[model samples]
Target chain A: MSINKDTIVAIFLLLFCGIMINSSFDIEDPGYQGMKASFWPTIVLCLLSVMSLVMLIKSMVSTTDNNLNSENTNSQNIFLKFKNASICFLMFILFLAFLDYLGMLIGGVLFVFGLLTLLGGFEIKKIINHSIISIITIGIMWSIFTFGLKVILPEGEILRIW
Target chain B: MIDVILQAFASIVLDPVTLGLMFVGTLAGILAGAIPGFTIAMGVILTLPFTFGMTAIQGLATMLGVFVGGFSGGLMSCMLTGIPGTPSSVATTFDGFPLVRSGRPGLALGLGLWSSFFGGMISAVILVALAPQLAFLGLEFGPWDYFSLIIFALTITVSLSGGNITKGLIAGLLGLFAATVGEDEINGVARFTFGFDDFKQGFAFLPVLIGLFAFSQLLTDVEDDKRAKSPLMSQSGTVVKVEHRQAILIILKRWVNLFRSSFIGIFTGILPAAGGSISNILAYDQAKKASPNRSNFGKGEYDGVIAPEAANNATAGGALIMMMALGIPGDIVTAVMLGALMIHNIIPGPTFIQDEPLLAYGVFIAFFVAHFFMVGLQAFSLRIFLLVTKIPMYVLASVILAYCAIGVFALHNIVFDIWVMFFFGVIGYFMKKLGFPLAPMILGVVLGKLAELNLARATGISDDMLLFISRPWSLFFLLMAVISVIFPFYQEAKKETLFAKLYVPVSMIVLSLPLFLMGSPVRMIVAVILVLTGAYFLYKRTSSLKIT
Candidate 1:
């Protein structure tokens, strides 16, 4: 039997809440008026646990209505869609990594150019124009926040000199 | 008060920088709001980091401009493309598109803008008068009362959860748990940090917000772009010149619907979690019920456009009342705005009004000024907004992703927050696909800490958890929460087990036993309510079962 998305969510949340509750044990309880540092998390996790269990039961009981969960249509379609979107997602991850090392201004410009290139039908001319626009836009954004507003942005190891 | 208001108004108007920022915010709001997939909350959030440099008045005025302009701008798409620019504009499309198709797009747009302006003005007037009174009432709330009030506020989730009570509850609970990740407010001990220094300070509110709403939407837009080509409007440059005089006369004739819808908007806006999405639909429903030309509502009736547009815009004003007076946000946009205020180290509470009267008055005046700007701009710049709507999804997504990254980075100059945003973005996207509502979860995060802090304080003060129900207001809110949770199910299932019918009320009554043992009148009243409701449910359930 294939696990429906709801069942998966429930199981994941159950495990998450379990971990959360267990971790609460590590904190020193204040024990004042039977309330402590762990009190609220305990209450929240307890409610979450109950609700997650209910969701699991409901998902299990209504397996016939699995079609109601739209994401469960077909594994292949889901994968293809995820794969298509993964290009952008990958660009996002790369952008974050770039921002970490290359600084906000340079990293932002590169991130925009790369994402636009992937999105721009792969025509060199279109990619070049999109990159130009992306650079101008990112430049303006960087100037406004970094220079105009005096907000700090990452300068990268190499770019920190200038 | 009058002098302060005058000074605030003068300061905003005379200062070109502040005025220009407000203008920019309004223009950006109109463009963003006209986009089919963008929400006003996203507009406000995208504008938040921009405000970090300005003073409280300048920043807030700019945000308010966006708030008003965004609400007004949704009708552009609704009229031009049959797409509701924001969730609040969903009802606008019902009659608005038909009007566009009927060749009076100009009239529909004109009516919607005027309606929104009037709605905004009316709510502002009411806010100016009512907020102080509410603030006074807010000052009376103790920890227990505040906790109860939050319970009552959270009942709004029942109405908002898109008919998935269990999922909504789960989402809200998860949010509360997420809020507990940082150091404990009472003991300074970390509960859920899992040994990470980044987790110790907990997830910053802005990062979580940006992730949930803006970044998640970006990812979803990307997915949608991959799945199907987005349908673009046919005539991207078409402009229909509205006969303003005729439209104003038509609006003037429907004064009753205007005022009534605006009032409904304000009332719903005051209810936490029930924002424009609820108010606009309600206003439209009430207009349908009250209008002489009910048949024309969905057939391109001008009153139909007016009802929702007016109501939705009015909600901005109504929501501000709760935010300013009580320190609690009534909806997502206000919630973000609350975060904005908090970022400036201005804590909102009963004393918020007193402590920051000048700024408070400045916000009120700003709302009024924003309406004026929105009206003036939309009148001459409809084509500009139309062009903005035609921006390609991928281009917008890429820009939004970059903004999300850069904006979060600018918040604390920390890279960890970016990761936090990315993580929640994935969660939010999947949650949307799974039909779990995001608003409840957001409300949970925003209110969870407030609820827990107050509940813990109340626990400390009273030395008994059950003593929360000993107060009259506390008991009332708890009882309301119980009813709110059950009422949806009761409506869904007309026939249920008799045992099930008695479960919640019986448990609540039993739970109130400590108060009863303490011989408090509050418990007696609560017990009576539970008994009556329980008996009624039992009677209905048994009769329905027998009939079936």
Candidate 2:
């Protein structure tokens, strides 16, 4: 009775496709020349639904044939394994969320330093190394974008300076 | 023509300032190409303003240097970082990174560089000899034919799917769906937006590309602490040399692959709107199909690296030919170049060569010479690039991610693109975990807009759905698409099934029909030869069956 990862993913994708297909109907046809805007999206969603259904059936059949509990067991371990990556991804999200406040100069440097520490370790030597690398890398990047390319990096609302 | 070419060559070579500018442009292109989100089109656009002050020939030559160099530059990042620097080099990363992982980084780099050089050379020669003829061929493709061609290109998803065909199809469908999320280009209807203002613009191709390939790749690289602290390449301490001689020999040995891939690049490049992205993947698929060691393709096969690198570089020459001969920009980079040409009061078309013989020939020379500069400059630049391997994974990942964010932001100065990159990165990571191939999805995203645009155009012209298969060019592409779809299955069956046995003969017979209908003597003769070959094969198969 245990559901495998593939089966779960297939179900999720199938539901997504159903939702998309439902949304496609709301698009105004306009009765303009050529196919409606919904036409291509609907065709793609239908194909996606079919493929997801196939995946679901295939995974279910295989699971039944093998009757393997390993996948179910391994599913729990997968969450534990993704701990480092999850933390890193969260840090990235936080960096973006605070980007307008801190600006790319500060935000970028802090994000790099934070990621480096998260990934490399919390040792004093590693922190020093990470800080230097962060400042140098972000400084070079900011200079290039602002001066070389003449692209305006976000200056932050708090630290606004012309 | 000879006089024009000689004059053009003399003008470019004799001027040190022009040559220096070209050298500098090539270097800039390489740097731009090595960055994950910094595309060749961006590099050319940056160089456009600089070119305004120079003479037309000087300006064109400088941009051409950037164009050619940018194509070759992508392989460095692809091989070293496992993230393609540009979309065209996406396929190169398949084998190049794996080869680097397998401790053959030198060979992989060398193979990529030399293949790019040779491919560029071949395309340049073709551009010189057959620009007019090839540009005319490009003019023949209608909306139906273009749509069919995209369908044929989409068949690569099957080949790229690896072992899981269902996941691959789903992934591709998801990509196509992603492209349809914004307002419809043709009718301006909001699609799948659900009141989100950001969704109205749709997902840009670059952010999606960087997220799926670069960001997701970085996440995987730093999955654990041990892997995170380590260098990108395990053998980082060793002095990695670009084994030029050995790579050249290998490329020479695989001359057929080289020629075939280059020709694929050139042919795809000639078609307006079709560019290196399609050609590289097409060449890689074709290489996989034709290779004796096909199983080794994704696992660091040199042929895989060679095919895509070669195709992408050759694409520049093909694109330039279209721009110079027909006033039609083949791809975005050429579109930028077309803008540059227009700024200089130069208009390229059917009578352009006659009117501006020296300038036209100068462009050809610039393109041709740019390859030589690319080869020479890559040798020096690659050494500097290899230093990236020495950086710890954590530092490299963090820096690259920041750059990705900045690059995405700079693309349109939008924070939404950064979110798109992050979202796709998460999705890409899971897809990799679930064993869904990423290449097919990337291909889907890349071609989705073009396919929909063409389909809309085709349908808008006439409600006759039959025109898709009735038009000569459209029928040819449709037939090719059918063959391409069956090819993977045919490869698996390998003459065991009746369908497999008849695949070659049937393909030849059907393919010849379109050529025969093309109404040119050369095409008719080629069609006749194809029919004869097909008949001979059929006769031999029947005879063998009777004996059995």
Candidate 3:
């Protein structure tokens, strides 16, 4: 598996952090006896991590089977790999931050446009078309959610007056 | 039984909402399915969360529409572009695409449209009439039967997990093992929990699905197009006319092949793990098997188009029967349907049939009517969609990613889930790269929680663990599970060597201790089987250094 060990580590770290944080949630309360509500999933994370750990170890200890065939050997460009994944991570973090702050529609438009322009480097005309289309799409989406399904979506300062 | 039919007809024919949604879903699904790189499986997974807010009938009706439309939509690409829009339509592309290339596009579309619709309607009629009988069969299942079912479903991964048996087995085992990570439902003992609360709730099935299909694809797209992915398929030409008499003659000539494929589709649909893609492949192969013109099977034979189109479409109807009435899903689409049902707090099974016959029957109506609308509407729009098939997939890909983002954000009005979606997406992308079968993994996780829940409830184990598999129902599933867990490696050995493989049973005699300790006679059977199978595979792996 070509999955970066860091990403897997990051996932486990996040799970570990969640376990720590949630465990702090009313630690004093006597939970489900013989098994707290958190008990099963906690077990799951450890097991998953251990499995990940085994995977990591196997990945590390295994000899390059690629020795048998050049095509099977995967030698990647470090910079390109780093650049793509970093950009992806950045896009996600930014989407979260923007949506949390500006609301889904406006934030979503910016994210879509930004991801396209920054990651893709599309022509300016394409960028504009993408932006306009995204805004309209999100707008229809917002209406559908709020009016049709009545799902309470994030209303930015623009729509709070309503 | 007659009342059930009447109820289905009455609810579907008369209910405006059910009919309308089914129509809408069918049209939209066809559009989605006909496009390049857009799969119905992903469509089903993506929409599952949205269904959380809907009532059971409405939600199920929507998915049913999507299923019908998605399967039929693949024909659009086949007739227009020569590329099958979905994998199931691969055979259709052989014949339908050739006709388009021959400037007989309309003929191709006419054939594909009629074939898909006929197969769908016929199978759906069978499903509507026979689903209750099938559901009763499912109701007879015990834990072991379900366990065996999961086993059979999981085994299919070996066939599909790319060439290496070890790789497939490892991947399948990883999925099964991943399933065990969550809480032990039988004892409330967190078997693998390292204290994470989310871990206790177990992994979110939808997010994992997104990771495997959406994220994985997105990552691959990013790399392939230098990351500027478009989800659309480019195309050309419009439908050509075939004489009315010729069309009828064509259908009748291929009637035997068509019926066989349809039945294959329905049976496959009923089997968990084997979905439309498998049925399509199996049906296409069967058509060739039965055809005197087998050599022409791949070179634009009508049977090539009819076989898969019929089977893939038929499977959709069959899947619904199990999902709506039996609670268990036969494949991913129905698996998503299962998630949708939980949203409405409606448990599917005999109880659902007894309590909500109207809802169940109404869904049948939705299936029939949606096919009707798609058939009627596409009859006119077929030419337009056919001519415009040249749009690139990269542009389409961007739009779907955009919608995926929007979908995640719309649910819970929270960005957290969006991140979750992205997180899973990236994971899915990487997992695919590594050669793991994420579908089985997702299945394992989805059923893992429930399996654990049922196991716990059945055991009352703290009081007495031995009683867990004592019931006939539990015992049956347990025996099946035992056979299921070990059979793959055994099959691998038997296929590889005939005589020396007899020693495979030697280890079975030795590793009988651990399962015996698990206490349940059913599980002990499984344990002994696992030990022997694992040993045999370990031997095979050491001996065969060649990965192929």
Give the top-scoring candidate (TM-score): 1
Candidate 1 is scored at a TM of: 0.91
Instruction: Say which docking band candidate 3 falls in.
Output: acceptable
Best by DockQ: 1
lDDT of 2 by residue, B168-240 (tens): 7788788788888888888999898889999999997767877776678778877766767776555423336
Residues forming the 10-long window of minimal summed lDDT in candidate 2 chain B? B231-240
- Candidate 1: tens digits of C-alpha lDDT, residues A51-158: 999988888877564553476577777776675367767887887877757888888888888887776567878787778878998898888888878878888865
Query: Mind giving the per-residue lDDT tens digits that candidate 3 earns over B72-111?
Result: 8888876676767777787777666776666665566767
Order of candidates by TM-score, top first?
1, 3, 2
Compute each candidate's TM-score over C-alphas. Answer: 0.91, 0.75, 0.78
Better of 1 and 3 by lDDT: 1
For model 3, what is the error of residue B445's alpha carbon versus the real structure, in angstroms, after optimal superposition?
Answer: 2.7
Misplaced by over 4 Å in model 3 are A1-88, A119-122, A157-162, B1-7, B49-53, B141-205, B226-231, B239-245, B380-394, B461-496, B499-548
Docking class of 1: medium
- The DockQ of each candidate is 0.61, 0.50, 0.26
